[model samples]
Target: MTDYVSTTPGLYPLPDWAKDDLSDLKGHQKHDLISGDESEEITAAYEEAREEVIGVQQDADLDRIVEGQLRWDDMLAHPLAVHDAVETRGIVRYYDNNNFYREPVVQDDLGFSGDVANELEAAAELLEADDDLQAVLPGPYSLADLATDEQYGDEAEFLGAIADFLEGEVDAFPEHETLFLLEPSLVESAPEDGLDERASEAIDQVAGATDADVVVQPYWGALEEKVYAHLLDADIDAVGFDFVAEQDDNLYNIQEYGATDDVSLGLADGQNTLVEDPEAIRDRVEWVYDQLPVAEFETVYLTTNTETFYLPSGKFEAKLEILAEAAALAEVKAA
Candidate 1:
């Protein structure tokens, strides 16, 4: 039987404790926290929030646990914005979503700031001894696409520099079970114009920087063959495809590509407000599995297509519960 592990793409809904004064704190207070001016009240509130979310995931019996990314105030651009070499530019739409992120402008050579590593370490302290912890970060190509480049005028040069910069950041990450490199730009824009090969080389640099298993999760939708096949060149452990948003295309891609050593099948829709019943979710997973080249993969991960931050707090737990139950059901059915 395949090891059908359940996990998330990180950036969970903001905990309730941090939501009370959100309107008042939207501008200045948020800046204060991001700039390292957090107050005692804010610190305590986040701690409680983290613990609560962590407890929820633990209770759901998820195989891999994330840090909840409560401090990722700027979404995928947060890590870059906080880097000493990058500057926070004007707000820009995050991919096709209604959400926005402060575009990080590369002003100088990039380097690791140790922020994510510290956050992961704190999360490790809160987990049980036997729990398997995982860390998530934006992939190099995606970060480059999100940021404005001033230091490096050329795209190829900028991409190479960004890869090296992300390598340093990954080096700082604490030892974990897996490192999920979220690469939305790769699929969202579809590099059918021959940019896919260059992206493959850059992706290899970032993934090779880490010793932990690296899973490239392109969340928006299915990738074209040019981009998807290039992923085979990258030295990553698993490739995640979103079956929720692009089930038809994803299934087609999987069948065409045959399969891989491991696959992370995104079943839950994090963007939608409607929560799914566990039985329905189980059936969906089973349907996807029926089409999958199961013999080609040793393990499969059940997860949401994107980050859960888009979800309302009240619906987050239900989604996770559904995911957990579906994972168990899928495993049983496969057995």
Candidate 2:
């Protein structure tokens, strides 16, 4: 049976109480807090919000749960931006989305800051002993692409440095059974001049540093054939394609390029406000199964194409319900 996983790529919208708690600091601000000191109310809110998300996941009977990255200051770039060797610059648009992130400027040699590991640790503490928790981070190539490289003059060198830094970060993190490396930039700005080998090398190094099963998820849209084919050569366990954005293209890519060791079917639309029908989602999953050469891959993951952080809290919950229902229906039909 395919695993139904929740991928929290970035900041999940804070619940009302959590929003109210952080009102004193800055509510829905585009930038990170100048001071890292979080109030008691905000701290409690984070804990409460986590418990609620976990409860929802448990009720939905999801195979795996994500940390729901409620504290991401600048989306995927926050962790890298806050490093001692990096500095935050002017606000910049986050890809094609309405969301924005402070541009990360690499001031010197990159290093593991342990900020992400600490954040993951807090989330890990909240999980039950039996819970299969997944930790997420921005992929090295994507992070290198996002940041302004003032230190490393060469693009490949910069990517290597960032990958090594992430390798250390992954090593520091608590033993996560699964780790997701979000690689949106690879698809968003498909490097046409053949950076494939370098990207694959960087991804392999970072993925090899951890004992956990690593999945590299490229959201936003479908990757070009050359890029997608090269990505499969990476050392990660699975690759997640954005079916919500370009379902036909993604499905075709899988048919043409062939399957990876495993695949993540992103059936849920993350950015849409309208809730998808459970039956419709189930039908889509069935269609995907028909198209895919299932025996070629080890496993499949049913999940959102991107982060659920784009949706309102209510709609996000509804999407989860949809996923849970669809998953259950798929199982019954298979049986």
Candidate with maximal TM-score: 1
Best by lDDT: 1
How much lDDT does candidate 1 score? 0.81
Q: Report lDDT (Cα) of residue 135, candidate 1.
A: 90
TM-score to true structure, per model: 0.93, 0.92
Off by over 4 Å in 1: 21-33, 294-296
Residue 264 displacement in candidate 2 (angstroms) = 0.5
Write down the worst ten-residue block by lDDT for model 1: 23-32
For candidate 2, write residues 1-335 as lDDT tens digits: 45544434435676766666566556656464533346666667777887777777766666677777777768888777668888888998989888888888998998768877877787788777778778788888788888999998988889899999999998999878888898998888776556877887888899998898888889988988888888888878998888788888888888898867777778888889888887887798778878876554555667788887778888888887787777777667765
Write the residue-wise lDDT of candidate 1 on 131-245 in tens digits.
8899999888788888899998988889899888878878887778888889888887766555788888888998888888788899778888878888877888898988877
Candidate 2 residue spans exceeding 4 A from truth: 1-10, 27-30, 34-44, 294-296
Global lDDT of each candidate: 0.81, 0.78
